[model samples]
Target: MAAQKNAGDKDTEEKKKEKVLRRPPEEEIIIRGGKGASIRRKEIGPESEVPSGTGKVAGGNAPANGEALAVHKEVAVKVDHLSMKFNLSQEKLDSLKEWFIKFLKRDIKYDEFWALKDINFTLYKGERLGILGLNGAGKSTLLKAIAGVYKPTEGSVYRKGVLAPLLELGAGFDMQYTARENIYLYGAVLGYSKEFIDSKFDEIIKFSELQKFIDVPLKNYSSGMKTRLGFAICTAVDPDILILDEVLSVGDAKFRKKSEKKITSMFSSDVTVLFVSHSLAQVRRICDKAMILDHGKLLAYGDVEEIADRYEEMTEK
Candidate 1:
């Protein structure tokens, strides 16, 4: 009887151990497609320690491997320790007397917010890098920094080739001007020669599928039409380095498909692409490597599938 009791107790303990080792099924959530896939929230194992003297991250610290160094040899764009900060301010309403007093002192109250901090990465010719992060994670800020629209508060960016950023389409477009006139205006902003713009004018109009409205004022066109025209004109100029934000998501499905094909073709060519998108599937399809940013810091940078898995894990939280 004593032996039997001991055996039963051992069995119970073994069963408990087995249950503790088991993990629950991961829940799937679809963003924009077929059956939603479950987010993988598994902790990643440590990668092999790369040798020293390889490359560097933000703040001028060398990376574990020569990843950035190797890319710099082949590509023209190198971002090093890029950071941006914005000042937040609010007006204080005091008594009229207090306000007058403060006005005499010329004192102001404000708080500083870091929009991007210590962002470091490298891009090579013909490499497509995808940037993934939630809103306010500094996606747009990074692009603007690379485009030279916002100078980094810290660190520096190095560009070896001409960069054409499709950030804000029609950013320089004159609403009152006809598409023909805006073509010259927008083309010049993108670094195109007048002759080049003249040569590509018909092609741009044709690709936009807005030839019928090409002579009309840009303000007269619908939003979709405007987006199509803008995209066509911007992308028509062949660029060595292209930065694409979520702007491609503006057009209709047919136009979107066409734009996708155009982008794929560009990817196949020598053009280096820095793409920012929330669509993991699209990112996986186009990018060979991806980087995840959270609160202005890089969480991971590596193979697209691996990074995507890590990103999904993070979202599950």
Candidate 2:
């Protein structure tokens, strides 16, 4: 009996050793600087620069011991009881007259749909948070709410920095206008002055690789082209907080790689990022912390690796 117990203990020790061996090595983050364009590589540690306390829920759900609150050194984004309720029409009317008649008769009905419900979490300055979920999980809706594009039915979002949100492609562009004109228009929509846009105009175009088509109407551009232009313009501004929703996956493979590199370069500047992507591996690469949403409710939020593992399990099932 003693021999059997010793054998079981030996098996457990072997499994533990194997698990540690399977861990990947730490990666190096590249930092760029100077006119000479010198590059410096910093080893990324297992721990994040900013520690998200035990309260991984939205709105800083701190633990009773106050450990979570103590670790959150700087607050950048705070969501308080955030809930978005959309009144979806129960029936479709083919014509405006029909809708008006139904409305007048009090026959119209709407289904209350909550895209996000009492979501809570506090994001610290310089922390990258990856939001994970299946389709219709309200990831995009949460970003839109945080970006101030949608007003919540309950609670509020507090932000303490210049926010740059890249949500829908071609959102601020005028299809009738030229790409050059839309650059200015979209820049202005993002709260950049004409002078600021002027300074970054050439760089934006060069980065987008749209020099030849700059004068062409935006309506003539493809979805990927619009994504490139929007990404270039938004990233040029050096925003305090960057909001992204699946913009990285639209372009070709080469352009996608370039854009990923661009985003990686920005990490050294300590920009707070809220990213929603379908790629779990991408999330693990880009984010230190992550949150999981299901049916518009937050299920898990914490370290990226743990959340990614949990998300993978969910997808597999």
Candidate 3:
């Protein structure tokens, strides 16, 4: 009889054990479809662990030193002590001739610029992290590092899923080409195939609200016009990870709000967003977490409210 009682207790304990990041047996999986199929899941496991006092969390949920970091069974992006450096020449050499002459005499001089310094952070799947700093504060440099446009001088960044960066507006655009032609050109830069661009062509046109101006030469369009179209094209397709750098500031108030709505909708899916903006209000609205940087160093990293408060305090003083 005692043996039977012990077996019953063991069975109960075994039943209590569950899989990590899995819903309870009674919970149901929700699937939705439109452009693509999406599964709604209840976030379980160590993801709910609160951050440590300094914004770095420890314990079992914390990531290892160099592993494919998983904070709670899901990691969208991981940046490990990332840094970037550039060298600026002391003297201006207007032409190749001047540079060659300086090289022959061994008189080239440069000052090292550390654009970013030992910055470390992580973004879980479906998280929006806003980066805030004043001008010349390495905000854009950090975004460029994550986008793989500029190689890091030290440390590394690991990202899963397809990434779409709205870093430079119309980077590959041809001034002589028409708006319609530039779509194919910029689309290619964004990693979209010709067929995909063709299918989404009309959708992009309508969203930009530039149908009448679609066939006009890009050189003739105003800066705002170009911004509208570029924003429309980049946001048209859903990205697993999105990076935005000052792209929203060019548009008007109404258009900016429209773009915000589009970005806000991304939150419904498992999309990780990284952005740098001077507009603290916009960042606070779109991102739950914010990282404050000053002079190439991390000043604060925490909830948007905390970081924003810290930033305001610094700026005010």
Best by TM-score: 2
Candidate 1 lands at a TM-score of 0.75
Cα TM-score per model: 0.75, 0.77, 0.77
Tens-digit lDDT track of model 3 for 244-317: 99877768898888887888888897788998888888888888778888878877776687878888888889
Candidate 3 residue spans exceeding 4 A from truth: 1-70
| 42-135 per-residue lDDT for model 1 (tens digits) | 1111211122222443323223345554524443456766778887756764578877777789866668888888776766567678899999
Backbone clash total for model 2 is 7
Task: Please list all clashing residue pairs in model 1, or write none if there are none.
Answer: 55-63, 56-63
Per-residue CA lDDT of model 2 for 1-317, tens digit only, reads 11112233455356445533222212222211123322222222222322234246444433323555435455667676778888888777879999999989999888999899888787777889999999999999999877776766777665545577888765678899999899988887776777777878999999999999999998999988988998898888666678989977878998999988988888887778999999998999999889999999989887788889999999999
Model 3 steric clash pairs = none
> How many backbone collisions does model 3 have?
0
Error of 3 at 127 (Å): 1.0
Model 2 TM-score, 2 decimals: 0.77
Q: Candidate 2, clashing residue pairs?
A: 53-68, 57-120, 57-121, 58-120, 58-121, 59-120, 59-121
